[model samples]
Target: MIHIVFNEADIPVLQQAISLDESLQGEVVVIRDDYAVGPLDHTYAGEGREARLNWWREVLAGGDYEGKTDTGEVDDFKTVAELVGTLRRNPEETIWIWAAQNKHDVSGYYWLLHFMKEFQGRVFILYLNNLPFLSEKGQLFYPIWLHSIPPKEFLKAKKLARPITLSEFEVDPDEWIRLCQEKKLVRILEGGKKLSQHDADFYDIDLAKFITVDWQKASKIINQFQHKNKHTTGDAFLLWRLKKLISDGGFDTQGEIRNMKDFEIKLKSQHQAETA
Candidate 1:
């Protein structure tokens, strides 16, 4: 069996859960890319390899993406394609996808399903985004990811997951393709409804209010606004967005742009004066 997850942070919790059961051991694949925030043109096999590589190259072409170049990400895309191709070749292996309802995991899940259209083996999705979980206090709550659950609870959820039916997946593959073409950003709520982020700029404005403050303090203030896990963008992603704001004269900053601690952020005087 092969288990696929959306990010590296998810891998350790999953690996620890898988370790508790020897039968669940298999290669854990992390997609290593965020599909939630960018153009996903030619992201699947139907669009062809050249187009896919071109899209990835253009996105990673400039600006420090966690300090990786366009060449590096192009290679990374090839690595992912090759890994999926290997999984496609094995008809006997069952593929398990660990996904959530958020755009990050949902987009990856749909893309993987699009690629595995020809695979003969069973495909199961442990969609944990809304799965009911029991806490140490024995209270029921829906966890946004398997990592949110305790290790022992994760193991139990793994056991409870069932194989997705052919009929079900058949109807949704086209929907996934349509989603890839969408230009607007969204967050998936419970029951698969999407909340649009078309006009949201609160993060940039709110964080910029913390003038002459390190990112640590800024992030702490910003975190208070993150009420839901599905809608929460990571501190790194927020910082990247903040950098763009700084570049656009929405804010001003001092020190290394890439290193959060090395810089202090402040609202631009023009914007500040307008607000005042």
Candidate 2:
């Protein structure tokens, strides 16, 4: 069996889970790209892939991830092709796709569905949507990301697996195609397998809310925003947007903007003078 996950952070925990239960043992492959953001035009091959890579180059320019775009790290198409090759060679091999209740995971799942149609019964899904699990403190809570769940909790999650039905194989691919056609910069999870599209600046308002007139490190503002908001894109994406906000003159900045810790950001307002 082969295990597929969207997030890199979830990899270690999943490996631990496989260690605990040998029955769950399989190679965990990650689709590194965050499908929730960026252009999806012809993403699978040819000009579309180049366009998407160009967009990523633009987004990562002048940031920490700059020049890291072509490192062959974020190739979902190659990953899927390799998986298909493996499946074709090993007829008995099965695939388990694990997804949590979040836009990132769900969007990744959507992007993968189209390619898994040929593998029908061999493809299984374990969606942890609205499912409650015990934390280390023994309190019950729902997890938004698979990495958020303890490794032991995955034993219970594995039981939720079921084959991707024929209807879903047919319909879900259409849904993904439709989403790609829309080509929205952002995708948000509305509910069970449903996603809503938004503009690139969708999270700008929330990100700005964490900023104040007082100068604070960019890292602090980003950390605070992530802690306060339930739904968040990754830090790299947020930082890209933050730079956009800065360029738009909605906020003021100090120091270099390449790395989060290298810069300070504040609201665009005058400071009050202290009385002697």
RMSD of each: 4.4, 2.8
- Model 2 scores a TM of 0.95
lDDT of the candidates, in the order given: 0.61, 0.90
TM-score of 1: 0.74
For candidate 2, lDDT tens digit of each residue in 1-276? 999999999999999999999999899999999899999877676888888888889888888788888998777888999999999999999999999999999999999988898999999999999999998788999998899899999999999999999999989988888888897889999999999999999999999899898999988999998989867888888999999988887677899988889999987665421221
Question: Residue 260 of candidate 2: its Cα lDDT?
Answer: 87
Name the lDDT value of residue 55 in candidate 1.
Answer: 43
Off by over 4 Å in 1: 45-66, 69-89, 136-140, 185-190, 193-230, 250-252, 268-276
Clashing pairs in 1: none
lDDT of 1 by residue, 1-276 (tens): 888888777898888878888878888888766655554545554554455545444433333344353435434356557766776687678778888656677766766676666663477878875668787678898876656666667777786567876765786677665665664433343356243333225355555544443334334434553553225565555656566666776555666655445566664566575884
Best lDDT among the predictions, by candidate number: 2
